[model samples]
Target chain A: MKVILVGFGVIGKGVVKVIDKKKNHLKSKYGLDLKIVAICDRSGAAIDENGLDLKTALKVKEETGKISNYPEKGKNMSIVDVIKTVDADAIVEATPTNIETGEPAKTHMIEAFKNGKHVITANKGPLALYFNELTSYAEKYNKIFRYEASVGGAMPIINLAKETLAGNEITEIKGILNGTTNYILTKMEKEKLDFDTVLKEAQELGIAETNPHQDISGLDTAAKIVILANSIMNKNVSIKDVKLEGITRITPEALTMANKSGYTIKLIGEVSENKLEVGPKLIPIDDPMNVKGSLNVAMLNTDLAKEVVVVGRGAGDIETSSAILSDIISVYLRTKNE
Target chain B: MKNNKKQKYNNFNKTLYYYGENMITLDLELKDIPGELIRALTPISNMGVNIFSVIHLREKKTDGRVPVRVVISDAGNRLNEVINKLEEMDIIITKVNETTRKTDIDIVVVGHVVDTDVRDTIDRLNKYGLVVDLDLSMPDPFKESSARMKVIIETDKLDDLCKELDKISEEKNLLFIKSF
Candidate 1:
């Protein structure tokens, strides 16, 4: 399979590293030989019709901070240009998310489909804002679109519901979708620290971003839930449809009070038949939903299966790349016979 | 005639009502004094009802009252009599079987809990549910204070109570973190 990586940030670099690491395994286990035809970043794109060397790609990206600096295969070409002209079977759209507009990534995906290429993206922006539009394009061009990494990174949720638990009628989906907020809340409850104190400590420890508005303000979780609502639950919803509440107001005293009643506070994002909301909810201390630390957990309420809970690391370079790689292989297996 | 009546009562006691019989679960709030639990259970015992399991929620005690779940065999169609007897003894029956007569909800309010007319806040919430337990923590008067309250309300009125909390939140600039 020939693939084009659309972004060269942490996740993009991680994808290159993973594909290199699993080259032999992918070939031996599934008889699948994967190749990266191009890697795009803000600096430009590096193209190789005969498959770019994975090691040199990572080295150039690390040393020069750009894939366009690759020895002779690199060029100053836009992402759209690469999508339109590159001879590749699929495009792995791992661009940075723009929740407000879903731009750039949105354009990249639409162009990928229009140019007769399949898309396997981990971008949440376009999915949250333009799911129907983007999906319509994919169907119009008859390309397979897979995005298991968008929701719970490395935690099989979208595919788990749509594939493994396909026959069950899923009634509700709820869990802690964001890891940064979970870390802050878990630390606060454990040490009885205020939100500001704990958040600063998390930022220093790199668990939280310097500007942690989206994760802390529930926007990130809202975006992910919107994707699940649209794709898994078959609900036509967007980011604005979520009734959001952040954890800024939570105090140590509040956690103590909740503990008094055998409960703990978590920023739970819940989507059901009559509800779509994200806020601080009281989870029973011993419940499965009460996973500590930066781990993410989700519970799917289905008619036949009753209830299914999934827990995993919601973020990381290689962790997220693991999910992206699965999608790549899935696209391969499904289209291999064709 | 008195001997016959005594013999019938004795027979009712001897008949063991085990599984598959009509079982009634009573959710009661009892005073934390000695023999309070027995005082709440003695009425049904005298009515010839077989007792099953008593789950005492000791950790959920608030305001000197412990919540206990008492399951008993409702033999002889005496559910109403058991309820009346317990109520007559001043035992607060919060729920019976699957029907919730009343339920306890906890809310942690953050803000100037005392300055923003906390009395009116509680009074407004009291319209939908009774504020049974309140624990206030005021780190500094100039800063925001936190208050934890336990409200016992009818299950049907939970939505109304939440709406009222939202209204109070908007009106007084307070954040009500509720346990749903």
Candidate 2:
């Protein structure tokens, strides 16, 4: 699969590193001859008519903060132009999520679909807001749309629900969906500290963003719920459909009280036929959904087999990019089948 | 099998697998009454679905019920029949997790749900082929209970789910509030 990766931020770099590490393995094991035709960042896009030397491109990106310094770079073309003109089989949209507008990434995905290119996105905005439209576009153009990294990072919740548990009907999906809030909650629970104190530590550790409204206010989890509801359980719902609550109101006293009651307070996103909500809830201490630290866990409730829970890191560069790579392989195999 | 050192560097873990062609996990909420959990799992065992693992949260209590998570794989093609039997037994088969290309709609059913027998209403809705998943909150067995449910049905069947909700409201004398 010849690819063009847009948004050369942390996830983009992570994708480059994972592809480089798994280059030979993918070809040998999966029969996927993966190649990168172009790479783009916020500032500019870099193109190589043939495959680009990603290692050298990574070195340049690390040193100069731009891939335009690559040996065969075009003069900073727009991402749209690169997506339109690049002779590639897939586009990896790794841009930061913008739920408000679904922005440049949404337009980029639309452009990719218009050009009959498969898409793998880490951005949640487009999927949360316009899942039906984008999915329909992919079908109309006969392109594969995969966004494993959008929810659960390396946990593979999307793929697990989509592929592993294939026949049983999914009734509900409950998850410790966001790592930042979970981190804050864990710290508050273990250290008996308040939300602000733990949040400051999280910000310093680079787990929570400087402007941490989305992560703290439960919007990020809401976005993930929307994507999961639409992609897996097949609901045409959006963030607005979720009854949102954050951990900001949770106090150390409350945590201590919950502990006394044999429960742990964690932000849980519950998705079912009649309910979509993300808020701090009291999960039993031994419950699988009560995973600690930055780990993410999703418990899928089904009719036939019962309940299955998957747990893994919900963030980090390599972890999330691993999801993008899986989506890439899915597209590769699907394309081969076609 | 690869060595641990080599596996450590391999970032991608292959999870896109179907234990066979059909694997599912059920999230069930059984009435705290004795034998309810047994009643739920008996048909599953009888149908010969490969039991992967079962996690029964006996200590966790919600809505005066015990939440159990059962993982099973069906290669013999009898999983649906097992579910149908469970439903007929009024075992409160709370959630059926399977893979489908259907939209999931979540809503909240508030007030006196358990008194109206939510299981019967769900079974009635199932008659229309609208798959339903419930997370109920009936903290006190003697009082009113609300539920959060995810309805997995085709896009065209959304109206059907809504109409069913309306019917459930009228018949059960409850308020159905769709989560925004």
Candidate 3:
């Protein structure tokens, strides 16, 4: 199976590593000759009728962190050119989201589906911004459209909630979905470190980007929860559906007061009974969510289960990419079965 | 890094797999008592199919009952055998995923794969220039003694990483799942 890749960022590169590593395993396990045949980004796109060399591609991505130089490395063609040309079996849309406009990536995904290719994504902005329209096109085309890596990175919460918990109606879903806010909150609680110190550490660690408002203010969590809401609940929800709050102005006094009262603060994403909301809250000490530092993520208070907390390294090229691989394996398994 | 190292793998080769198929969920409406879920899951565990995911609880306070959803992964031929056993045990079969695909993948890494030697590991990754996104650490409640010591790689690693770990596993007591 030929795979066209988009958004050759950290997660995209991770997908390349695991896919290259497990190429044979995937083939033997699922009868899939999975090949990443194309890639697209803001700068440019790369496509090859023959399989793309993932290792070399990662080097180019690192050297310039852009897809502009792939043809410079003497590949066949540009990524967008391939999206228009390649008869790929699957499309991996990993492009960065322009939340304001939901551009380029969204256009690329629709084109893939229109051309009858399966679509998988790590981009949330488009989906969060326009899930209803895109999903309808996917269903209309009868293609496999999955986004496991979008919300929780590596946690199998989306699949677990969708397929595993398909029996009972999903009554509620909640978690410390954003690592940036959780990092700051965890630092405030443990070492008397203020939000500023934690934010600095997070940026250095890549958990929080340089401009971390989306992650810090809980908008990221809100966006993610709305997506999960639609997937698990099979309903349409928008940004307005999500009530958002940021931890921007949280004071040490507030943190100290929460600590004094035996509570810890966290930016939590929550969805229940079709009512979706996300924000920072003071969770009690006894809450199963006393999860501190960077390792905090959980699906809480399901009518069918109290909580299925999957805690781990939330970010990393490989770790988040692990979710992509899991989805790829799933797509391979499904595709091969046909 | 897709490193195919000079290491051996004692892997479970050539296991006949059933194509996409539904795994049964033995849903039960039991009282929200102390040992309800454990009683259900423990028996299923004994029966052999790996529990992929499980959930059970009573939502409505008005009605005191629990709904359980258990997703399992296993080969067929034994599929009927497992279902028969669950039925014999009076396990109420609930929702079933008609045709689900489960990948044969597990993550096993050196427990302290990046402990004191964080820089070395980062350097290794940097060779491939794989961006490390979300590698921040949490405060260990039990922050024990430290050395540049590598702990056992037990649970999960990318397939290529598995081959590399197999080479150094013997020297480092890497508790990898499938290393020769």
What fnat does each of the candidate structures reach? 0.53, 0.00, 0.00
Off by over 4 Å in 2: B1-180
TM per model? 0.90, 0.67, 0.62
Residues B1-180 of candidate 2 have per-residue lDDT tens digits of 478766755532322354445568776667678877777777777777677778887765543557777888863457668767876885555566754324434445556777788779778767654544566665577655656554545555666766786678778876554422
Question: Which candidate wins on DockQ?
Answer: 1
How many clashes in each structure?
A: 0, 39, 20
TM-score winner among the candidates?
1
Error of 3 at B8 (Å): 60
The residue-by-residue lDDT of candidate 1 on B1-180, one tens digit each, is 999999988877655444446667889999899999999888888888888889998876766889999988765567888888887887788988778888878888888899999999999999998898888989888988888888988888998998899889888989887777
What root-mean-square deviation over C-alphas does model 1 reach? 5.5
Query: Which candidate's lDDT is highest?
Result: 1
Q: For all candidates, state DockQ relative to the true structure.
A: 0.42, 0.03, 0.01
Indicate the TM-score of model 1.
Answer: 0.90
Error of 1 at B149 (Å): 1.8
* Cα displacement (Å) at residue B115, model 2: 34
Q: lDDT tens string, model 3, A1-338?
A: 78888777767788889888888887787777888877766677666668878887888888877766875434435555677777788888877766666777788788888888888888888888888888888989888898888887777788878777677667777788877687787777677765688788878977789998778767778778888888887778887778666776454545554554345667778888745777666566667766776765766456666567666656667877888877877887787757
Residue B177 Cα positional deviation in candidate 1, in Å, after optimal superposition? 1.6
Off by over 4 Å in 3: A64-80, B1-180
Candidate 2 on A228-324: residue-level lDDT in tens? 9999899888888887777776666556555654567788888998888887776767777889998999999999869999999999899999999
